[model samples]
Target: MVPLRNQLLLGHAAEALPEVRDSELGDDTYVLDRLEQGRIAWLAGQDAGSKQAFAAADSRLAWEDEQAQYRLSRGLAQAGSLLTNDQTMAYRVPDYERTMLHHYLALNYLQRGDAEGALVEVRRANQVQEQALKTRADEVRAAKAQQEEGGDEQMRQQVSRGMPELDRLIGQVKNGFQNAYTFYFSGVLYEASGDLNDAWVDYQRGYQIAPDNLSLQVALLRLARLRGSPDELRETEKKLGRKAPPLVPSIAKNQGQLVVLFEDGLIPARREFFLPLPIATSGGDFRTFTVAVPYYDNRASDSGPLAVSVGNRHEQTSALVRLEALAAKDLQERLPGMLTRQALRLLSKEQLRRSAAKEGGDVGNILVGIFNTLSERADTRSWLTLPAQASSWQGSLPAGDIRLTLGAGSAMRELPLTIHAGQTTLVWVQRLGNRLTTRVMPL
Candidate 1:
């Protein structure tokens, strides 16, 4: 009967239970099958022959000792038959199967209208299940880190940015070759996890490994633009073409101080705007182009005005302003917004809320600032900040659990965070006056 139950659980038929015709079947075999069959029968609300079958099966599995004691406890709770634990003293159930049985018992109790019994069983089963889930997650994480660090590039191919299916396949393959695909996938995974630099590293590695891949080419182009690097533009153009993707033109007075560089210069606008200007790159050496700080926004009927400042690289020089009205689908101008949305979704809800609060003045400005900082500092260390409570901003986190080597003159700090169930972590960076504070919070 025990074997029959196992077969049914495995989706095999009960009649397929192995035959032992000469001897009387033991309670282990009968009760196990009866328990399972009874549950199914109960669900269908059919008692007809199942009751007789189960009673006969239960007779063989009657409690005798330790096993009996366990069954008596379970049966009392399940049947509501008024039978106490001391009455059944002779059956045993394995611990692994125990919780599963308890769940079924709880369900049965629910069916019988014994809410208290059902609640007790549900709580116990939930505790057991929670522990099991935690164990599985820990095991999975350990396996992945092991594969990532010790396994070869082949292992990389098997790993699908945390996809279980890919991980299983990778585990089966030859364990050691690192290839362009592996790094490409790694980049995808890292990017999904809000680790842009890590993603960039993987993309860079993939590009270095296979410079001709068009996808890599696209990635390089995007990365360059985000960094506000004219040089990157030139380098990308060498492989691709000279035609520049359309971007918003800078409308700032002090284009020099705005760290973000574009052909037209730095944009200083605090609001969402659009510039239909084209971006040009040579694919040769990356060059530096300066744009004004306050950028022009053509999204509205009136093209926003430009404000040039005095302290630019071409300081005291007359500012060269390009007033261009952009179409709705300019790739450069359009892409940043799309990417920002994608990035935001990858963040935890808490992180998203903080970003929203800080950007209450102008979200576009904040988005531009983040995109430029991350892109430009691709080779350097970069961080992001979220809004703390009123009047303050959250501190920077190191992106992942990785320990970073501080760049020259970089300040370091430690943050403690709690990892919660079903939630990921988000860290924000802030620089107030000369003091840098990184506030770590849960999402």
Candidate 2:
């Protein structure tokens, strides 16, 4: 029941925010509560309050070192067997979803002016990305090895037949696990901490992946000048078609700057899809069967980037990352494992039916078959509370009071901001329809 409620909240986070805020659930009692409370606190501009909630949620979602060792041992123990006979498998959290939590915590730290803490979170997020990629590669290798050893030609053929459509969908994803937004934010933190060398490296990696991103290009140019790299600065300038702006002098002097990060809409949710294939049985008979699969539904959210006005100056936040793309890529990377597990499950059920027919009457076999078919279900779990997309904009503003407006006219909401020179301020905005939640964090 808690899982179902969590799914609902994740699928409709904007709609569910009000109810979650009204609930009496303690922050540490349940994972769902922690997730919801953290999001609510962040949206309400309570950066300090969200720390504990996010920390609790992170600890729960994390894969401990011992857990990985246990999983490895279990895999080795079950190796070379046709089927492990294990009916239930534990839920595996998606890597992108887990990385988002770390990314958000890093933002929370940045809002609180903890550069060192933010760097730690960024490093964790990067480690998660690396692990996810390695795990997927290993899964693909294992699936191929299993297919060769088991001589599951029919299963391999079925997977190949389904590849066309699946590959087409996978190809639509622009990026995978490495998030440009995380890289950009990390570069910002490094720059703020006066680590120009590390900042340049981060900016270079980010720009390599997202060359169209002006913010990254500018950052690279700034670092190039500071590090006395004329060639790199020239390359970046040529890519941008103009000279980049200088680093904020006040920020350099340790006064302060303002950074606005916006989480536009809800990320796409996972939905179940079915694919029917013909399976060859031991009796040389072919049976048409259906298997449940999961895919991303992109039409869930259509919210665009926000137009922000700080005092009288206006700038629109640029798209930094698309969670939908990353989610799709993650699914694609895990496709081999998904196909293998589904095929194995179907084969096990078929064997059960065959055995039941030999041991009992036709009525008993039919009952067993019915139960197996009814119990067949696809794994549809995901971190549903993630935003559809995230965008950011940063600028230098004098230390003083200012009015910030998101959107325009009746659709707009005005919030006050106070900036201090030589420091950093983070303004987070989440928009759902005409409703807006803004938080101002001074660092």
Candidate 3:
């Protein structure tokens, strides 16, 4: 439903605003719509408009984040969903998506040349990440309590364990929510503002999450050596092991660094399918009934690296994080809870069907069953506007007005950039469908 419309409206962001504002806006997806609207506006180079939309989305989410009652209300809301499907429940942003919200908001601020505003959003994102880790246990306990009320834990666990591809993909990351891309970006921001200490901390954390990233490895080494942290330097070098070769030298006093941020394609959307789950009937016999569930393509792909050429000098962007992988991991964490909710919903529907048969006869029961089947929709909702992959190219460039050439596949684009001495210049690039957008920020 939303996924289809999102794909259709992918490149034509500005022209599609009226469609969401006029027809498709729903009470259930207010926050999601706002997020989509913000993304599109940002893509269209409307930073102010994007800021407004993200703010509206955050207003509701901020309330939920501040109030413990709102977290408790999630279970209460599920009670109302028993008669219907999971879509009836209001959309709750996954931990990763919520963090991205602040991350994107920071970008919006940056687009407007508001560093303080961007810093605030970054701080908020960091707070949310910390909060998610702390509250994960409470959330799991709440879900467990709700599951005990209805649904079989054995069946839930079976379903969770059965998705081999999903399990492997989720295992790629430490968890479903934390990503190195955000960490790297945060570090870059802090470093741009001359906060080397905070930048060092963020880079260290990013390296912890993704040890093999060359950019992170170089950042750690460069900082440790520059700031006289020989112990930390040796430790990182040891961690790099045999992989460390052809070492990249630190930027000299006269040269500036070009930090390229490239976002490729769109995040993989969820597909819907009906699954027949086994449950015991009133007579103690097991029966299988169909329930719609959401899934994604778990296969991995290597599209090679983005090539960055400046005159004779050449560099390739390294993968920081894959959004689709993060999405899959997030979905895996959410599956158990989703299955539990589906079980409760199906059990409730069974009682309703029996009541219909008792009161109105076989015809009424058949009609109710048909209605249930028709209304049984999987909640295939997500922040569909996110990029599929995030990558970066970090290297030192001689200070001057330089022509920067960047390419991924068939087409290549060139831009003129001005790099100052002893500073960092960020080149943000996005390839959405046939259109290409680039932003230059000198720090």
Candidate 4:
């Protein structure tokens, strides 16, 4: 099961959409089916279909029956009645991936020249982001409160002793679970659709979260100019250290605007790491045990930028988001709960083994201990098909042909694109190493 899951994940990471689409495994696996359909639909430029499919899946998960099933499955897994393997674990919808779905749907609507629909998707994306943030915060708070109320000083000390190691592990990674890229795109869409007020709000929100993002800074400056706020515009210019460019004309007005989105590589995969925990027994002695925990490996893709040419001008794509960082932060945020659960599980197993030793001598104790050890597998399930990173390049040009050159020297390839007046063109490029898949959606 682990190998199969890794294969599917690596396949998507390598942009093997065709192979995933033709697989028979998805017929029985719900997550696999959804992921495969998403890749196929997006790659085929069937945005409407992809949007509907993801929406339907989200609705289904929200249904009462599905909710009950999920709860039961999770309970059984935690109680040690079910295996900790991928198939038995309850599915978790990756928050970042869900947010990206809305972001992509907005692009889809824009491609169809439906500005209102695009706005709706942008609003939905923001809502999802806010909801995810609040939900995670509430869960963490509740967990901490429960621990404080139930645990004694010794237990608290034991937990605290592990903090330094955990902190060190987390410190190696950067960024958080928030999606500044989504906020940035939402701001851009809002501006394009003439909602300058909302555009300013999103731009400011994004900038607050990722202050180093120059593109978002440029967005705020453009909004300031549109709103005729000279003071704010000047403030933005000083911060930017240069004069800002003129606001991009509305793409819906027959102006040619090209937006290239590149989804490069695959997000970091979750792997298990075992940590030795010391549990204090009633005898005033400590029992040394091991618990398995999950962490993200810092493996990233090294795909070069796509050099885009709009007539005589040339620009390379710039990083829009580091998704692996978000993934790492998400795991880091959940570490507290993970540690608590593992500690409880280990304590329970130790109690059981001790009881068996008192009742049935050394032979029974050995058997029970072996059983506990065999059943103590770590939960390694995650949404594994998300992109490693996302990048974008946007420019306004005369209605004509545009050229995109990917790679360099002997491996260089040219992709020609055509744009019409008052049109916004979306060019999606997925790269896995040297392999590239490009699609164009002209709106």
Candidate 3: list runs displaced more than 4 Å.
1-11, 21-26, 68-73, 141-149, 153-165, 168-171, 241-251, 277-279, 284-288
For each predicted model, how many residue pairs clash, with residues at least 3 apart or on different chains?
59, 12, 0, 3
Model 1: residues with Cα > 4 Å off, grouped in runs: 1-39, 46-101, 149-443
Quantify all predictions' global Cα lDDT against the true fold: 0.33, 0.66, 0.77, 0.63
The TM-score ranking, best first, is: 3, 2, 4, 1
Model 1 residue 375 CA deviation in Å: 50
**Ranking 1 against 2 by lDDT, winner:** 2
Best-to-worst order by lDDT is 3, 2, 4, 1
Instruction: Please give, for residues 1-443, the per-residue lDDT of candidate 2 as tens digits.
Output: 24433533344433444555333322222455566567656655667667888897677665334477747644643332223322234335567766777888987887777778988998787788768666766776786676565545676576556543434433434445767777777777777778888778777766666666656765666677677777877886787787866655545664456777777655556676666778788899987666666777534356676788876788877767777677777776666666666677677777878888888879878987777656656555555556767777777677777888887223567888777766667777766546555667664
Q: Cα lDDT of model 1 overall?
A: 0.33
Model 1 clashes, total count: 59
Q: What's model 1's lDDT at 34? A: 50
Give the winner by lDDT: 1 or 4: 4
lDDT of 4 by residue, 403-424 (tens): 7665422234578877777555
Task: Write model 3 residue lDDT over 110-198, tens digit each, in one string.
Answer: 87788878878887887777787788657767776777676866556555554435654454775667778788888888888888888
RMSD of each: 33.3, 5.0, 3.3, 4.9
Ranking 2 against 4 by lDDT, winner: 2
Candidate with top TM-score is 3
